[model samples]
Target: MSNPTLDLIRAHGSCRRYRPDDVSNEMIESIVEAGQRASTSSNMQAYSVVAVTDAAKRAELARLCGQQKHIAQAPVFLAWCADLARLDRACQLRELEQSSEHVENFLVAAVDAAIVAQNAALAAQSLGLGICYIGSIRNNPREVIQLLELPRLVFPVTGMTIGWPEKPPRTRPRLGLEAVLHRERYNPNQDEALLAYDREMAATGIYEGRQVEIPGRPGEMEAYGWLEHSARRVAQPMRTFLREVLEEQGFLLK
Candidate 1:
């Protein structure tokens, strides 16, 4: 059976290079509408998307996003924000205190934003557009918040660059289903699967000639394979200040 949706998802890949063509406003609106149609937590829809088309703003955003040139070149840059500020305004209108300061609310907002952004990405893919998610926006969330004029109870979760691809990107590999799917109970014996996946990934030339910094060993370097690359990323604190930033945003107040 040919499942178009599954096929589309299976063929997904991040596109960094795009054509110089512009995405029509109508297409952008339709994509965002698809995003809005995603399931929301408690129907709160605690998320917002800011579309940046200005050249200067995109340049600034690219700098904030670890100086990624693709962000600046993309026709549309969408910042997906976990936004509870609107909910707070809604509470004020009803003369009720906002409860978005709790950890649960923050989780809900972040999840909502992620789900919505995925929906938008799928829609864009269906329209023959390519997209790449920029998680590096978290490297300096404070600056991104300031640049986007984000209020309290709102923070950028991720950004997406969308446009017509200059060329089809190579599909990246993923872990086997057995590695992630647990039936009756959680399976602890994952080493074999991990090792097998590591070999398979090593055969691919995707990370060839790339240098990766291992955690706890500052000057130490390693070949960029999936296992080592991912391990290094998880071994250290990528965003140590996120908790403090969330606290400043009135989240994680228990």
Candidate 2:
């Protein structure tokens, strides 16, 4: 039940283990080429990527992600940056009154960076490489910027650590059709079916220790599930500084 494209994408999960196999410079160049081919916004291509393999740099990066060992161990880690700086410079040279100050331009560039990064991720997966998103790159944005030497108006949007998986994690169950895919306009809520789905998910052990970890949090339900896990995330201040950090990087620079 696998077509070429579907099978390729379905094969992706996350890789936290890797052998000592060193990825050659040629291979890294090819991977970058794969990513560069992704469609862009108005051909502006408002994104940049920095491939980090230096041991010292990787070590610093590990701490940025709360000491995630995979960051240091991965054969390659790519920092995907939303690069509005290049466009800004072009405007400066032309003495153009830059109007790209609104939040929409920043959002569009961020999406452009991500769409291309996903393309590279899928391509790597097809080549028997495993990739995991290191979303914590935003935890301390300026550190990442200084480490990568990103310019003004450019911000690190995300990180992708790639290597061969030492052991595969389960594909992880997704919310069933009725819960997610909606037709026509939209439904703000679907309570009963969602509860049933949550119950089924708990039986699958995905929420095994969730109740004990944050008893007062969202995922503390007797029927543990993904919703509970998501609740705990939003309950915290994890994403609180993103907008502020983006501002510091001159992202909304008018």
Candidate 3:
């Protein structure tokens, strides 16, 4: 089947380098409008996107996001947020109690935010713009909350940098369908698929000329394959403070 949308998705890659040219306001508005068209939980629309364009703010955001230069250089930096604050305010106006602190509510808001952000990314890509998602925005969640002036019941979910691409990047390899898809029931046997994918990725030179040393193991190293890289990533605690941050934001209360 010939499908332009699937083809575009398959060819998509994270854009780290971008041209100095700005994405026009009309395009940004269209992109965000596309995002707004995405389905929301109970039509609550619990997501908000903070568009940051100021040079000084971008620099601070880049610093907060682990010094990712692309964030500062991108023409647009959008801070996607899971927001229940507006719902709470709505409840207040009607003299109704707000249950925004529930874990289910948090999940709903986060999922809504992610779906909308992906829609916006796809819209930007369709317009010849490139985007890179910055999960490192959680590195300093408190700072991000303060910087964006997020109220209670609102939390920064992720950041995205969007701009005109300076150059096209090679499409990265992904796990085969067998590794991710199940017919009738869940499959627990993924070792074979994972190993095959690791080999395929290594052969593609995706992580070529890079050294990924095993933590706490000196002199005993192996090829930095996808399995090794991903294993190392999960071996240690990443974003351990997220729970605390969410709790502070009046969420995840079961």
Candidate 4:
């Protein structure tokens, strides 16, 4: 009961190492065209992608994204933006005032951007290209805004690097469906499923070499598993300045 698309999706893995080949503009446009076909809320299409190919700019962007070498090496770096400025322009053209301050609007735009980027990623993969999503683009939002020349109501949601794969990363395991899927009503009791998945992931040795040490209690755990790694990630404070950055981008959380 599987098809090409489904098989492709299941086989998906992030490509961190890429060959030095370039992704042509024609190929990029075709991929984006596929993205443009993705469903959008109210057909608002509140997203824009900025493709950065300039070596210097890509280097700078890689630096801004915590020195991710893949981003610097990839031939193309796309900045997916939640763009409400175009909608605002539409209102201006109609001589009507547009309000982008609502939190709902912000959410809508972000969701739109993410959906489109996923479509684009699949399209690239279909063409035998590789991609890696870079959420670290939000690390220096203000500088990114300036570098990309994004106007008000436009926020960089994420970035993606696309190129020919030098080597593809191993397929990562996902949690069992029992942990996430529930019929009819919500099920809060999933400890057993979680623990089982933790054991399964531990067996794969995914975090064998790169284990995050739990602060104040280093080397307490003999074998680090998915639970411990994810717990550490969730416990840490991340992107606390996003609210202020969103405000500066003219998106009001209220």
TM-score of 4: 0.94
lDDT string, candidate 4, 1-254, tens digits: 69999988887899999999899999999999999999999999999999999999999999999999999999999999999999999999999998788889999999999999999999999999999999999999999999999999999999999999997656888988988999999999999988888778878977774455555886754457888888879999999999999999899878
RMSD of each: 3.2, 3.0, 2.3, 2.2
lDDT of 3 by residue, 12-50 (tens): 999999998988899989999999999999999999999
The TM-scores of all predictions, comma-separated, are 0.92, 0.89, 0.94, 0.94
Best by TM-score: 4
- Show model 1 residue runs off by greater than 4 Å: 209-224
Worst 10 residues of 3 by lDDT: 206-215
TM-score of candidate 2 relative to the true fold: 0.89
Error of 2 at 152 (Å): 0.4
Question: Which ten contiguous residues of candidate 4 have the minimum total lDDT?
Answer: 206-215
lDDT (Cα, tens digit) per residue for candidate 2, span 1-254: 78999977766657778766777777777777888799998988899999998988988999997799999998888999998888888898999855667888888789899999998888777677778888888888888999999887788889988877777645756667777878996876878667777667777886664453446676554655766766777888767777777788776633
Which candidate do you rate higher for lDDT, 3 or 4?
4
Question: Any runs in candidate 4 off by more than 4 Å, and if so which?
Answer: 209-220
Scored by Cα lDDT, where does model 1 land?
0.91
Candidate 4: the clashing residue pairs are: none
